[model samples]
Target: MAAATPGLIGAARAQSARKTFVFVSGAFCGGWIWRPVSDRLEQGGHKVYAPSLTGLADRSHLLTKDINLDTHIADVVNLIKWESLENVCLVAWSYAGFVGSGALESVGDRVSSVVWLDAFVPTDGQRVADLAFEGFRKAIQMAADKGEAGVHGLAKIPPIVVAERDRAFAESKVTPHPVGTYLQPIKVSGALQKVAKKTYIRLPEFPQPHFDKALADCKGDKSWTTFELPDIGHMAMLDAPDRVSELILQAA
Candidate 1:
């Protein structure tokens, strides 16, 4: 089926009942990346929580080779548990799809739905690095082998991947993601699949290493609602907040 247009998405969203949301950022980024979309969602009377993972964003001071996928999963899982959040819409972008899926094993019953936004959906025991192309996987592994990859083992966001206006800002904010997070095998209990609803949003305008396979999986699955945002990059929450919010609301 074709994706709903922004206008149609808006119409559907307007009638949606407010719900709680938790957004996990992609590699090398913090929860701050979801501010644009979260703000819009909140304005529509929803509760939103965008938590930074353990070793990235404002939490970079805790970076270590020991910060594996489980650590990242704990970060979000703990948030929901601590806040007593329920009936949630969990949104994971990029690598966090792996992290987020693992986290759901513990709290899937609390979640109302799951959304993979240009993210990789790993099967049980699959790692983010495993889902990626060999070359990209090698690049991340090489960085981890060196103690801290990229900038002190931080993978810098390529300037060209973003639009000209936001390139400078994105460059300043992106940090190196932990190599351990990528290398560690993501474990799932199949709990995420049991959520009442699930959606996958694809940003084909700007490609990523592992998302195409994920997109294909979501498209073929009769259980998932899939949408395509043409000409929007993987960071659609930043580049296309209004549209992203509507799609999310549509799914919610």
Candidate 2:
């Protein structure tokens, strides 16, 4: 006997109930970086949207000395509002985590959950620069000294620091990030306090002392989850797309 249409309709409804995944990439990256993960998600019968932040990838022209953390946050917040997205599962990578957190502050009710992919989690009043390691800061300074303009010294990223072969491959795929975004301090009030769920995807290669402290502070908060991807790097999606996709599905 043929199955009833009502049963099929019920299955469709269950699938449709899955929330959309919105990926906000870090500095120097764009939507293109998320292609692998997005493909996997789509294959899994889910919709994924990756928005390139200002001053990165194909949007390099948008980079200016004036564009700061607030500007980046507004970009994501506006996308969420303009698209009328509700219960969004936001995934942010690297520097985009700061941008994502600020956007969350702006649209707390709209975000169903947040996943930080080996990224920063700034306090209420902190700048991305504050989170940078001393070596990273020195690299920026050296790059600026080389006469690279627009605050971020985009042209100097290649030789400043040592990177593993895979990490370099991922980094080489993107354009320069804006200096303004790094310099500008983020302003996050009670936004994180209101978000229903938060998760952190820690990469083994990157040192986690700072993040570990942050997570410890929020431990037992009943709204946070932490997972470690020992085989991944800062750019887990690009370096290990399958594992990243699996983690994302698990988080969802």
TM for every model, in the order presented, reads 0.87, 0.85
1-252, model 1: which lDDT tens digit per residue? 998799988877865677899999988889888888988988988899998898788998888778888888999989999999999999998888887788889998899988898888888788777776667778887787777633232244443255556666777888877888877777777887788899998888766646777778777988888988887766778777889998888887
Q: Which stretches of candidate 2 lie over 4 Å from their true place?
A: 1-3, 141-171, 218-220
Clashing pairs for predicted structure model 2, backbone only: none
Off by over 4 Å in 1: 1-16, 149-160
lDDT of candidate 1? 0.81
